[model samples]
Every structure is written in structure tokens, then in C-alpha cells.
Target: MARILSIVFNPSVDISCDAESVQHTMKVRTHNLKQYPGGGGTNVARVVAELGGHAELLYLSGGAVGSMFEKLLAAGSLAGHRFPIADETRISLAVREEQTRREYRFVPEGPVVTTAELQPALDFIADYGADYIVASGSLPRNAPADTYARIAAIASRTGARYILDTSRQALKSAVEKGGIFLLKPNVGELESIEGTKLDEEGATRAALAIVRRGAAEHVVVTFGREGALLAGSGGVLRVPARHVETVSAVGAGDSFVGAMTWSLAEGHSIEEAFRFGVAAGAAAAMTPGSELCRRADVFALYEAGSRTIN
Candidate 1:
């Protein structure tokens, strides 16, 4: 199994409820109500684990919610935790309304982690022999925007590749510091980084700019149902995203990045890895919740998706 370390700040207990649709604010019935350990890095770690890879999740956590977070991860077969001394982890909820085709999300700002607490999580990745460090998600208000950049820099020093996925100022900060091996950002995220609107052509151009600027060796743009584009040699390769009756959009991007990382770690080409990523993302959308997509689902989707793209 490959060693993959994921560092997440602002971890949370994700609760999702699906109603018929978001027509009226009336008592929207929930078909499913479940809580899981989630956040970009955590989701990536979980996906990696399901794909038969060794995953070690590192995050800032403390208090009762932190304890619960630990307990939740412990129930699984993953590796160690780098627990910090904080109060309780916050809760993030998603309300899916199929009628109106809307997903109403209520997310807390999450707990503020001290710099004192940040080191252990960073060191955990370094000491754990991580082959790839996935430092994703946002930091709390108290932390600097360059937080993930700092961690990625550390990983580079230790000879570990860094794959980053986030948004806004933090995303910019992460890549500038180097050590970013791959980047998976949606159209919106890409546009934000490029400081422009990301239509189809714009999205491809933006991804290329990131590669030109040397943000990462590979930059992937996911366009939801439209598909994805990879900025690679000669030119950017376009891979059609698999169409699915989307149940939940959350964790879809994480699944894509995780599968791409898995393929890259296995020494696949950029185009091959990007196709696998597209299938994985579609597989995630087919599932209901955050920890939904399984390795088997990804494999099946990949077979069909390969044909769809070719």
C-alpha cells in the first residue's frame, strides 16, 4: 500500500439530509440522516483508504467533538491521528432538495487552531513516511491564509509530493510556495485563481496558466457534468465527465483528486490518470453522502467512462 498523508484544518462532522426537493421551506423530509468525518483532506483520506491504499489522516482536533472525530476514524482501518488541543470540532450540514434541484448547506467556520497545535499535524506527515501530502480545505480565521502553503513547503523539504485543492487567497498561497505535485480545482476555483470567469475555454486556459506559472506539474479542471480538462504536454487533453443522476455534490471533487493521486502513484500517464479521476468523481455523485464512493464503483465507472471519452 502507498503512504498518503492528508492534512485538514477546520475538520467537521458532516450531516446530510435529502428531501423530495427544495420547493418550499416546509418540513422537508429527510430520507437519510447520518454523520461522518469530513473536510477535503479527510474525504480524500477516506477515499484513498477505500481504494486499497494506506491512508494516514492528520488534522487539528480537540474537545468532545475532536474525541468523537478520533473515535470515528478509529472505527476504520486507517493509520494514526495528529490530535491538537482545541475545544470541539464544528458541524457542517447539507440539505438536499431534489424538487428544486438545490442543496442548502449550513457550514460553521470551524474551530481556530493555535500555531502551537499546528506543528504536530505538520510533523506527523513528515515522520509518517508520506509519499504524497494532500493539504486541502480552509483554515480557521485565526490561522494565516498561507497555512497550507507552509505545510506543502515542509513536505517538499522531506521529498514528498504535495497535491492541493482549496480556494480563494489560500489556494494562491499554497502553490506559490512550491512542492505542489498536482492540483484539482473546479471551474469556479479555477476562475477565482485566474481572476476571470471560467467558461469552457477559459477554464482550460486558466489551468494552463497554473502549469505555466509552475504552481503544479499537473493542473486539472473539473467541470461537473460537462467533464474535465488537463493541462499537459503539447496541449490540454479534454476528458468527458460521466453523467450521473447526482444525489449529492459534496465530496465529488475530493473523490476525483484522490483517484487521480492513486493513479499517479501507480505511475499512470497524465491522461490516463485524468480519465480515472473523471470516473471517480462521477462515481461519488452517484452515491448519497460524503463517504459514498467505493473502489469498485470507481473501477466500474472508469470502464464505462473510458469508452465514453474515447
Candidate 2:
């Protein structure tokens, strides 16, 4: 089994519920309230576990909510390492509109972190020996923008392949620093990093540009419903999307990253893993609320695309 370490700098307790319609200044009644230990890295770890893979999650925890978060992780039986902090972990909300099937997500900028707290987290990651180190999600407020870049440096030093999925300057700083094994960026994020708009062709070129510049070994650019582009030294492989009845869009990106990493760790080719990723992303959309891709749904979609995936 591949030893995977997922680091969550800005963790959350995800709360999701459904309402008939969303209106301003009106008391809305929601049904089926669901809560989960959430954050980019935690979601990735959960997806890996759902896919029958083992991943150890490392996240910052504090306050009452942080204790609840720990219990939630325990409920799922996921292997989690909690690092202490003074601030409370934030909460993210996802509201599903039943009439239109739209999801409204409200994410808070996470708590501030002191340099003292930040350094220990970095040291823990640097010393840990894992086959793959995945750093996802946003950096907390007051945390340095180059935090992911520092983690990338640790990944290089430890000889672990690093997979980065974030946005804005955090993404740009890491890419500019180089040494990423794989970079997963959405269309808007790619545009932000390159400082320009990109069509499908433009996005492909930009992804290839990152690889050409030696910023990363592989670049996976997701184009929402259109599909995704996987570019690297070998070439670009376009993985088409599977049209499905989307219940909610939450967690789709994390599902894609987690499934792809799991597939690669299982010894599948990048092309094959990319196919699995697309399948997992589509599967995630088929479910409601913040719940990620179900294992059966992922397998079904993967097998459905097997004929054309290769």
C-alpha cells in the first residue's frame, strides 16, 4: 500500500442541509442536516478511504468545534493526526436548493496562525517519510503565502512526490518555486495564475507551459462539465466528462484529486488514473450535499469509461 499523507492547513467542520428555495431575510426550514470533517486534505483522505485506500490525515485542531471534528473523524474511523492550535477551526456551509438543484456554499477565511504554530506543523511534515504528500485547501489568515512553497521544499527534501491543489497567490508561489509532482488547477485558477483568460486551447497551452517551465511534472486542468486536460512531458490526454444528474457540486474537485492519487499509488498509468479521476469527479456530482463520491458509483463510472479511457 502507498503511504499517503494529507495535510490540511485550514480545516473545517462541513455542515450541509437542503431547503425548498433560498430567499433573503426569510426563515428557511432545512431538512436532513449532515455534518462531516471537511477541508481539502480531509476530503481527499476520505475519498481515498472510500476507494479502499489508506491515507493518514494531518490537520490543525482547537476549540470546541475542533473536538467535534476529531470525534467526526473517529466516527469515520479515519487515521488522523491532530496538531494543537489556539484558534478554533472554521465551519463551512453548503445549502442545496431543491427546486433548482443548486448548491450555495459559504466558506469563511480560516483562523489566524502564529509563526510558532506554523513552524511545528512544517517541521512535522518535513520529518515524516511518506510516499506521497498532498497539501490541499487554503492557507489560514496571517499564514505566509509561501506556506505551500515551504511544504513543496519539504517534499523535495524527503523524496516524496507532492501534489498541490489550491488557488491564487498560494498556488502561484508554489508553482514559481518549482518541484511539484502534479498540479491540479481549475480553469479559473489557471487563469488567475497565468493572469489571463483561457479557452480550452488556451488552458491546454497554459498547462503545458507549467510543465515546460519545470514548475511541475504533470498539470491537470479541470474544465467543469467540458472535461479535463492532463499535460506532461509525454503529452496531453483529454478526459471527457460523464454527463450525470448532478445533485451538488461540492467536493467534486477533491474527489477527483483523491481518486487520481489513489489510482497512481495502485500502480496505474497517469492516463488511466486521469480517467479514474474524471469518473470520481462525475460520481461526486451525482450525490447530494457535501457528501463525496460513493465507492460503487466511482467503480460504475470508471468501468463505463474503460472502453474509451485508454
Candidate 3:
């Protein structure tokens, strides 16, 4: 099996629960508490592991909360490469309302990372001979916006496929620098990157425009409810979104990238991988707060999609 190295600059401990109703000046009793190791790369690695793939996590860890994060990762038996720092990792919370089924999420900006602390992860990637290198999530505070671009250069030198999922300047800088094998950007992100408005009809053209510019070999433009469009040298392929009762939207994007990358690494066609990604994302959305897609749900959704396409 191919090994995947997932990098997360700022990882966290995800805490989730359910409350009867949320009111401004009242104490809302909660139940069904669950905690998971989180952050983009951590979530991606977890999904890969759930799908029976070998994934190695590379993330920054420190502080008491960071120690708890390490314990959570160990509980899942995930192989991790920890980068030491002085600041404690952040914690994110999600509270689901039983009455309205609405989820409220509180996310904190993670620790500020200095160049010295950030350099080791880049150095690790330069030497790591993994089949795929996935850098997911937001850049830590004070980290260079060109962080992903630097990672792209290393991937180019080492001959590993680079998969990027991020937004804003971090994403823009990377795409501008080029050498990304696969880029998963949502519709709004594509609009931001291309600096234009994109409707469904214009989505494929916009994605292809990114490919033609040599920014990325393949671009997947994901529409929250409208599914995704995959554009590459082979042209554009559309994968419709699977209709499922919404539970939580958190981690769906990461699940999509993780499943798609794992499927592609397992020798599936790009189209097939896209379908798997769609299914995995739907599966993630079907779960309650903070929890990712279950393996059984992912396979079940994938099989259902196969039937629909066939």
C-alpha cells in the first residue's frame, strides 16, 4: 500500500456535543460528548485510516492540550510525526441543537509559528519518500503565506504527488507557484483564485483555466450542495452530489480530499476517485458534530453511487 504523509501546521482537539436548545442567557445542558483529533491534515489522515489505508500524520504539537491531542491520536493508533513547539494547540467546539438540528461551531486561531519551528516539517517532507504529500488546513498565525508553495517545491524535487486543500493567500500563493498535482477548491475559493464570478456553467471553464495556466494539473471545484467538477488535461468531469439528510458539514471537504487521494493512490481512475470523494463527503455530512465519515458509511455510499452511474 502506498503511504501518505499528511501535514497540518496547527492541529487541535475537537470537542462536540448535543444540546436541547441554545438560548442567549440560559445554561444549555449537553450530552453525547465526543472528542477527536482534528485540523485538516489530521482529519484527512483519519479518513484514510478509516478506509484501510496507511497514513502518517505530520503536525505541530505542544502544551497540555497538545498532549491530549497526542493521546487521542494514539488511541486511534495513527502513526504521527510530531513537531515540538512552545505554544499549546488550539481546541475547537461544535454544539448541535436537538430541536432545530443546527450546529454551532467555535474555532480559535491556532498558535503562532516561527520560522525555526516551521522549518523542520519542511525538512521532513524533503526527505520523506511517500507516494503522496497532503498539506491541508489553515496556516498558523505568523507563518508565511507561501508555506504551501515551499512544500510544493519540495514535492516537485522528490517526485511525490502534492495534494493541497486550503483557501485565501495560502492557497493563492501555492497555485501561483505551480507544481500542484491535485487542488481541491470550493466554488467560492475558485472565484477568489480566478478573481471572477462563477456559475455552474462557468465552473468547468474556470477550473480548466486554472489547469491551462499550469497552476495545477487537476482542479476539483466543489459546490456544497451542487456536487463537484473535476477539470484536468483529460477535460472536465462532473460528479453529482449525493442527497442525504444533513447532520454536520464539518470535515466533509477533508473527507473528500482524503478519499479521493486514497482511491487514486489505489489505482482507480480519476473519475472513479471523484465519485468516491463525493460519497465520502456525503458520508461525512451525515454524521453528527465533529465525527468524520465512518468506513461502513463511505463504502455503502460508494456502492450506491456505482449503481447510480451504471
Candidate 4:
């Protein structure tokens, strides 16, 4: 049983390319195309590996695309297994323009995996050994929101805690199970959940509200470059990120979640884990590619310049 298991319902095979410019409603020339296995959970696994922690990526697998995903995971020396599905996996591309310093991306809906495919996958995860489970991203068509909720329940039955991140009914159901220790929801997603406009204050308020509701014991409201606010037993701890040059915005949030989970698994306190996440997010922001961060970079940023939002 790996200590960390990341699950993604909708996985992607990302092929990113750099383009000259992204003018409104116009075709543009692009270069520097590169492809790799993608999706939130896979990204988490990569970051965990970079941080010297153990993580296994469990995702829907089948067809050639699924085979490609398996190959990619194997290349990283990370353990990966497949779930049989009918549809071939989907693909996406990020086109970065050098002239205007802009990027345009082509994204497609991932495979619509069926319930038949999902059950065995869940069964496989039930046998997995992990201290913490990180479930992130959107549900493919036919996956009920509580899909993660059931998995979270499985983790609890198996003696492992889980961090659930997703939007809508899934988010609601997972919180209902009441075993989730930490949850990270963006402002928009939280807004949709609470049925109100969730701005900065509203986001924090929502975090406290969820805590009061007992869906989650601790909550972190991520505000992109604005930093993240933590809502726990001791109230909110605002972790303001230090300024850093950004090459690409891909996987910044995922890096933060992975790092925070890794730190806590490594026996750091909540405050220490918060700092670890801030540095990890900054490290990913400074990296040029997707879901890439070296442990050295995270530690270096931590020592040189990370600060709490006091």
C-alpha cells in the first residue's frame, strides 16, 4: 500500500506547444510541441515523486491512449494500473505565444468512462494501502459526484484519511461522509457549492461554514496568485505567497496540494505543512513545464523567501 494515492476521474494526455500569438478568433503558428501524460492525479503523482515521497496514480485506463499513459507512468518509475474503458483517452494542447507573451490552449472533454468500468477501479483502490488519499478533478460523464465520497469511505474503512477536491454534488457528498481531513476548493467552485458569490471574504466565510457543517475538519481556500487562506480548528491562517516570475501557470495548484499532503505525511505540523505548500506552489510557478518541480527548488524557495500572510 503506497502512502499516497491520487485519483482522477477525468484524465488527459497533454500535448503542449508554443505559438507566436493567440489573436482573437484566428489561427496561429505554434512550435515547441511536447506531449506527456496529464490530469490532476497524474500531476500529483509527479510532484510527489519529485518531493521524495511515495505516490501512486490510479486512473481509468484502456485503449491505445490508456496504453500510452501506462508507458508514461512506467517511465517515471511510478506504479500505475489501468481500468478498462470503452472510449480512448482524450488529448489537449497548450499553445504558448512568444511575441505577445500569451498562451492559448485546446482542451477536450476526457473519456466518458462507464459505471461498469468504475466499479472494478474502485475495488482495486480498496485493496491499496495508503495513509492519505488525494482525490481531485472533475467527474467523467456517468460518475456521480459522490464517486469520491465512496472512495473516501473506502479509505476510512481501510484506515487512511483523504483530501477531496472537486466541484458540485461530488464535493457536497464527500463532505457528508465526514472523514475528510482537508479540502481545497477554488472560489468559483465553493461559490457554486454554497449557492452564492464567493469572493475572498466569502471564500473564507464559506470555509468556516463548511467546518461548522462538519463536512471537513480543515479547509484551504486557494486564490491563485493572491495566495491561500486556511480554515482549521484555530481559525484561518492566510499564507501569502512571495512574488516569483511565472513561466507557465500549469499545475501550480496541484503542486500545492501535493506538497502539503507530502509534508503532513512526512510528520510536519499544519503550520509547517502550510509553509511547505507555499514554497511548492511557488516552485511550480517558476518551472517552465507542467506538473514539474524539483524538491530542491521547493526547499530553496522555502529557505530564501516564503512568508505567512500575517
Query: Residue 2's C-alpha lDDT in candidate 2?
Result: 80
Model 3 regions more than 4 Å off: none
lDDT at position 113, candidate 3: 82
lDDT of each: 0.78, 0.91, 0.91, 0.79
Candidate 1 CA-lDDT value = 0.78
Per-residue CA lDDT of model 4 for 1-310, tens digit only, reads 2488888777777878877667778887767777777887888777788888888888886678878877777877877766778987877777777886666677776777778889988987889877888888777777876798898789779988788777788887777676788898877777777888877888888899889877787888877788788898789888777578988767787888888888888888877777777788888888765646669989987776544333
What does candidate 3's lDDT look like per residue over 152-247, in tens digits?
A: 999999999999999999999999999999999999988888789989878888889889999899999999877888999999888788889878
**Candidate 2 lDDT by residue in tens digits, 107-179:** 9998888888888888889887888999889988888899999988899999999999999889999999989
lDDT of 3 at 264: 82
Better of 2 and 4 by lDDT: 2
Candidate with maximal TM-score: 2
TM-score for each of the candidates = 0.91, 0.98, 0.97, 0.93
- Collision count for each candidate, in order: 4, 0, 0, 3
Ranking by TM-score: 2, 3, 4, 1
